[model samples]
Target: MPLQPLLALTNSEPEEVECPAPAPAPSRPLTAEEYFSEQPPEGDIGRPRHLATKVQKFKATLWLCEDYPLQLQEQIMPILDLMASMSSPHFAKLKDFIQMQLPAGFPVKIEIPLFHVLNARITFGNIFGTETPVPHVQSIEEGDRISAVIDDACFAIPPGYKDATALDDRHCGLDDEEGLLQYAIQQSLMESGTQDDQVDVWEALRGARPVTPSPRSASPNLLNSEERQLQRAIEASLASLSVGPQQAAPAPPPIEDDLQAALALSAQEHSRLESELMEEQRALDEAIRLSLLDK
Candidate 1:
């Protein structure tokens, strides 16, 4: 009777308790690749979550001279666009401004030039959306006055041009590279304006000129293929200019003397520029070496 009563009392068995399995220990410390592979949680990742949705607008004014050629302007616009679109670590701070203030898909866009004839201004609108267009010239009168000043200061006659209209559309095309070079030469000479003391223009031009191998011989060891090609192009351009239609009338004694002097000055300037360029190249190479060492 006692055995039956005990058995009947414990009809239900004790409930089994569940336990979690222990986490397996890593075989070794995770490599950098493995550690970075596991993505952080969305909330943990820090990024600009709230930004302005509307596109921002900005304007930049290029105070080019009134006589600045339309073809040059067209060429310049694309260059400006290219410069703006180029990626640079220097522009890191602009990231937030670009994302929040600029147009949604395009980070940067230099729109077509807007020529304001009344004020003689070229406006390049951008999506920067920060500052208003700077008023370089307040009125048409001011613009006219500025233009007059520039003309008087910059565009004087050189001994090379026998006719006053030589600088006009009749002489230099301003469309072709040779014409551009001639135009530049004329402009430099004009700016110098028979001032014996002023060698600034020639020196500046010489400094700005791209480095290329000598035209007489191909020094493959000295210059890269690209440089050799550039040298050839420069030589061809110069050759074309030399063989181009020339005035039949001989230059006067004084003009001829002046031309000879100019040529001599240019030769001296070229030698000085070459020496300076070599020094600069050495300095640049040293800087690169130091930077590599630091890295």
Candidate 2:
């Protein structure tokens, strides 16, 4: 049996049936192959999107202290970030933060009072790339402070802040024998009577240059008044010997009586005797007078 539509009192004929459009088709979920194969969507292409990686160049300051407990490399990253945020004028104010961060129990007896700030400029192809040598890191003198770089690291240490062990490790004591010898030679050379020639030996022995004695330390070998007089007298005696006409030749050693008898003197000695010659001449003259008378 067909069912009749119910109508309202004032409503016209039964409301015409409203037909809905067919439902839209559902989208297919993307498969792995489709997602991977899809090309990137194009947009405005005025400039290239991929840029060359920037070359990293930056300056950093590092420090080394004698009693500083922490390795400087550990502090660099944080200190760098904090300092970079402030204006250039604010760097001096950061020293307090630096002092606070140092490890406790560090023996900081001789605080050199100033930080050695090693300013380093570094460049990199990548943060972990090979480290190339810096072209030239200028040496800057900032008031009582200086900065320097030593192979792989650049850092500063205070002027008087020597490592506690440096003296202990390197020192060797004074040389006893050498010291005593040097002292003796120095004493001898300093005496007033040391000769000028001896001065050279003393100086050579002590590894010193020959120098003229100062008035304060004049050598004793220099002639004083009395010494000068003695020197003059000796010089005069030598001169007298050299100047004498027919100075007697040095006498030979005396001949022993037994040796003299073995080698008797020749007639040459008799002729040289003045007494013997006079006797012979007188006898010859007497004979000549007697002969004349006889004639």
Candidate 3:
């Protein structure tokens, strides 16, 4: 079947053929473990990634608002760290306490403003007379003090941001009570020093005798007024214990007896103070409840 091929008469370019691109491979859905184990996106390490997004945003807002000096910022680092590392339930409790302080129907935007007020309170609230104590996570008294501070600060916020509630007449009473208690303790220590040539309650509790300061080593001028006063009181008490050369030293009590007596006195004073504080706190709570009801 050999046949002769016909020749093309005209010169024509060969037609070009177009081929379609192949479709992309389908992506498989990740398992729960794989998704959960994935790393966060880069540059978000500073954020508390374990917390809910809302809390993260709140913390970010707080960070932006904080413009304190480096020294003060450093001083508050422990508190800030405690807050950041708090468990979800603990944080929720803290947030609830904060909310309880706010007026009803206040906008959610007030949270940041309210926090600004709170930060100011924490900055200035040196209730301990010296540097403010860093609150422990599990201390009930510390928790109550924080709540009270928040309550006071809530009232201090500008009225334009939210409706003003009646300010508690006995606001900051806990702080006042604490100051009074410290003053009483100092007074009791001074009196005890004058009555007997024994170690003061503080030194006894610490299981050490007070070292008399050398005349050459005077207190620094940098000490605050309160600290200066305390130093003077200690010096006066020490001076009263000085024995005259002519007077014979009386037979001293056993060290064990003195220590036991000091401890017992300290325990009694502590119990009394605690009872007083509890009573005052109950009164304050009732007052606050009534105030809220009136609104």
Worst 10 residues of 2 by lDDT: 1-10
Best by TM-score: 1
After superposition on all CA atoms, what RMSD does each candidate show versus the true structure?
26.8, 38.7, 30.3
Across residues 1-295, which tens digit of lDDT does each residue of candidate 1 receive? 0111111122223444433323333546556775677663222222223333432223332233333212332544455445546654223323222223322232122222122222122243321222343223221234423221123423566666553212255131224544444433543454465313233344565665423322212333422432343334444444554663773333323323333344334444545777899999999999999999999
**Full-model lDDT, candidate 2:** 0.38
Instruction: Write candidate 2's Cα lDDT for 44-163 as tens digits.
Output: 223323333322222223333354323334644466457746545234333333344444432222122122332222211211111333533434446655443334324556476544
Q: Which candidate comes out best when scored by lDDT?
A: 3
lDDT, ranked from best to worst: 3, 2, 1
Whole-model lDDT values for every prediction: 0.37, 0.38, 0.39
Q: Return whichever of 1 and 3 wins on TM-score.
A: 1
Extract clashing residue pairs from model 2: 192-220, 192-221, 193-220
Candidate 2, residue 263: the lDDT equals 19
Candidate 1 TM-score, true structure as reference: 0.18
